[model samples]
Target: MTDVDLTADPLHDSPALREFFGDSYDRVARFAVMLADQGVLRGLIGPREVPRLWERHILNSAAVVPFLGEGTIVDIGSGAGLPGMVVAAMLPERSVVLVEPMERRTQWLFESAKECGIDNVTVVRGRAEEVDEVVEADVITARAVASIDKLVKWSAPLLSPSGEMVLLKGRSAGDELERGKYVLRKHGLVGSVHEAPTLEGLEATTVVRLQRQG
Candidate 1:
């Protein structure tokens, strides 16, 4: 994993973030700043584990915003609501659900969403595999959740027939894709991987898009 610069200013002002992301940009930036200022994220995962507010967390999360359609999104294992909360803050038109199994983390997610003033988000306290019946989402996202194979199994049922699964992964994404080929084929899913440039200049990050095969 690339070491994010904690001291440097990663998230810019509301106007700048808004200009970059449009209307909801300010809310997203505010949320990131609030997380840092309130020490919610740091308290949950320590200061060392928290990513840079703007670069690693906000922008990294926003990179996938373009791929999501104007439908519901379900984020599995939304620890600290990384991309889930960020996505909700950025795109209020779409409904965002953060699925977390841990009670403490779920509580933190709701608190963060409220503090961020994001009304489009909902917190579901349950594991991905157990709550598929209730969550029929157009897009399923998982960041640092599980391996590709396992994540596919967990997210499959929640996805709409035309839905896609987007997984945030690091350098070993290709390896994971290769390892998951058999499973993907068995599940009638085909995957295409896209690499997003990281601010840290370390290993490139990948956003894997998996769609159901006909």
Candidate 2:
């Protein structure tokens, strides 16, 4: 993890990130800085990630919000609350559950949520595979957690019967979607890949949306 100087925060002047975050600008920036600082100390986030907070983390995370529906959204392995906390702040009407297995990470999430003044989030200290409450979520999301197949395997059962999943994939989104085709079918779910546009001119992000077909 690289070290970051909190005083010279990059998120402060990123017009795109501020626009992307809208009214939650202050809290969101604070969260980004806090995560970059304490997150590296705790080994939750790479210290190098602090500089790329907007384009790499925040935008990619916030872009998926448009594809989501109103309901409970469960973020698997919500380390440092990438998309979970971001989503919670983006849409207060939608409930969010951040599932993290490590106590330290979960503590960071709770404290960050409180300090950042985000109220629509719940931190659950457990893995997605073994947690039953997660199965009741209306939607499931994750970023940099695991392969798409594994994510679907652990999270598919957690969705409400009619719920869908919107996962943030890397540049290899298409390849990953192809690779996970079997798992999606095996779970009796329908999956599709689409682009999530965050910054207009910048490259669009690949997002996979899944739902029960049966």
Measured by TM-score, the strongest candidate is 2
Q: In angstroms, how far off is 69's CA in candidate 1?
A: 2.4
Clash list (residue pairs), candidate 1: none
lDDT of 1: 0.78
TM-score of 1: 0.86
Tell me, by lDDT, which candidate is best: 2
Model 1 over residues 56-150: C-alpha lDDT tens digits? 66677777777776589999999878789888888888899999999988888888787668999989999999998888889998887899999
TM-score between candidate 2 and the true structure: 0.90
Candidate 1 worst ten-residue window by lDDT: 1-10
Q: Against the true structure, what is every candidate's RMSD?
A: 4.3, 2.8
Candidate 2 pairs with clashing backbones: 135-158
Total clashing pairs for each candidate:
0, 1
